[model samples]
Target: SRVSLVVVLCLFAFCSAEYFEEEEEFYPPSRFPIDPDANRTMCEIIQAKGYPCEEHYATTPDGYILGMFRMPQPNNVGPPVLLQHGLLDSSFTWVLNYPEQSFPYILHDLGYDVWLGNNRGNTYSKNHTTLSIHSKEFWQFSWDQMAEFDFPTQIQYALSKNAMYPKLVYIGHSEGTTQAFAGLSLNSSIADMLYGYVGLGPVISVTHMSNLWLRDLLELGVEWIWNVLGIYQFLPTPVELHSEFVWACAECPICCNEVIELICGRHHGAFNNSRMNVMSGHEPGGTSTQNIHHWAQMVKNPTFQKMDFGAKRNEEIYGQTTPPVYNLNNLPKSLPMMLYSGSHDELADPDDVQTLVTTLEGIVESVYWKEVRKYAHLDFAWALDAVDEIYIEVTDIMRDWVEGI
Candidate 1:
């Protein structure tokens, strides 16, 4: 019964990572202290981990309030780094591992002010100023809305609070990376506010996607499934029901690992299943069904354009024959970008990443690119060796940027 589950869910569960000199070598699950904060908020979990934490909120122009967690600088006001998680994930994604191995904590220990963003509709950011979350209109948005609203609002909020840091560094994984790409392209002013951009599993369009099960589902028509399943908010009901589904996975570690492999890719050796009992509690964070449908459209159609409404709806909504494409070429010519991709990532195919990089060639200032041959989509977030493999690379760049200023 270990069939692929991305057919139904587990599709966009995605991104994250590192830094330091001869720090205490903290290995996970064995040497690591277990996570008992499964039922806790990200701020509570961070506080319990003995870190100073603050909860911040930003209201997007569309009325949704995004919740963010900040790990303040220990002593001096170090450079600010804002992190965005991928589809169906929350800020909790960066804290699933041990302190030394976890990206947020490692950066915190390195004296960086870390800001974790929860995308709209995730566990933390579910509130809208005027709409009840139960209304279908509240769930009408996809990542299209996220790019247009969430990033700008969150980044501006962070910048507004901290006057010392003129511009914060931006880092994203999977769809996190996609939103930044789309956001920066659609609004060139985003580059003026960013010191640099780091994309852990930079996804544009999944041209050579390897998940056949997911691909087949997209091919079958998400609209048909949306109608058949009656899904508006993902999981029909949103938070409580989604939490129960994750609870089932947390209680069944073996099955959870199987699903991780199916959705993330075939590479599982790097995954840390020892603490899945805790991590799985936040595994499938939450998103709109329309978001997943939009992702399906990405797979079905080869373009990385805005979410496709059917031709008639497109005409009504966009005043066009088809949806408008996100202008990747419009990205600022001087935006320094760091891009990393895993060859084994099922969702972020190597070829697709290359296509994205090719489009970024003359648009961005400089690109630092690397591919991890064995890493799957989740490894960037949960792999045991990510600190050594990915985090150090990111931290090294951040260090240079901080020093130059």
Candidate 2:
């Protein structure tokens, strides 16, 4: 009897262990193939498009083969406008809802090729020639790397492909604008290649008014967990275990309710759950392992300068501890640039944009701060109603600028 009991116990233990192992394997350790059906409303609009969007690869100086999307202009006439997406989002985020809106599509119709860039560490740009995604080298990059390496390579590649053009215009949103400034400031030669620059909801300052509570929670949570795990670095992509943890907290019943309350206090009463769902992507998107480190630098030292790692590293590469802060004081005295803002955009408040404008050395030949009475940050890209008004003004500006050039 004792011998039989022992055998049965051993069999039960083996079965339990096997079941757990299979369960773990079923949910691939990565976060790819995110649930495309969770937020049906948002996915309905995003997935409606059947456009032929192809992915192109470019290698950085560091040999990172970054992923980019080439949305060919319908007629292919004007200079290609490099479309830089915001933090944590891949190029697909730019055209995910293309069929419903015509901003990007209109640009295509107007003969402007749109080359959307995906920054390092995003899902699309996940491979590197020398570094493995699991290594610290992969996570070493930040927005600084994007400005110094990614943008220059992408621009040169774009201009090389379209050799007929001497200059190209730029449209960057959020951190995209930050990197644009960093690129121009570090390599003035690239500045000569730009016909005009348009920054939408630019993130020059880290002192955000909206989304304060959520941002705080994220920073605190990351700091605590990373410290506990003895992980001093950022995750390479949002598929890792850490990324999952952060997302769970952000979307937790209590945390999400608190976030809604905060947004409501900001007078954004109609906070669409679908928008939040979409912004987070099919899974929790944009939680780079190195993101918190870079963000720490940005928030701790609120300056429009290149990352403040110290003069030695900066000088070795960028020639200064602080890359010139888009020396608004040095902008071509007559350069025509446009700065647009949303009234309810807490990230890039109207005051902040105005302050940035004032820093420009030249009198901005034209300025249009779209105080879309109720528009917020995400709405600049996702709001169905705001796109028409935005595209009309944007395309008109581009037409005038291109004509002048």
How close is every model to the real structure, measured as TM-score? 0.88, 0.72
Clashing residue pairs for model 1:
none
What's the C-alpha lDDT at position 378 in model 2?
Answer: 55
lDDT of 2 at 215: 51
lDDT string, candidate 2, 1-405, tens digits:
244333422322332121122123323243323334333332243334543354578999988888776665444445777877776555555554444463566566667766777778766777899887656567676787888798878777766666557677788877788787777666667777777787777777665545453355344544445445434333222232323433443354345333323422242323334334333433222434456456555655557665555678878867766644545443443445666677877666767676766665344455455556666565555556645647667778878767522
Point out where model 2 deviates above 4 Å.
1-50, 74-78, 213-284, 287-289, 310-326, 332-335, 361-368, 403-405
Backbone collision count in every prediction?
0, 5
Please give the RMSD of candidate 2 to the true structure. 10.3
Q: Which 10 successive residues of model 1 have the least lDDT summed?
A: 12-21
Please give the TM-score that candidate 2 achieves against the real structure: 0.72
lDDT of 1 at 32: 35
Residue 345 alpha-carbon offset, candidate 1, angstroms = 0.8
* lDDT score for residue 53 of model 1: 93
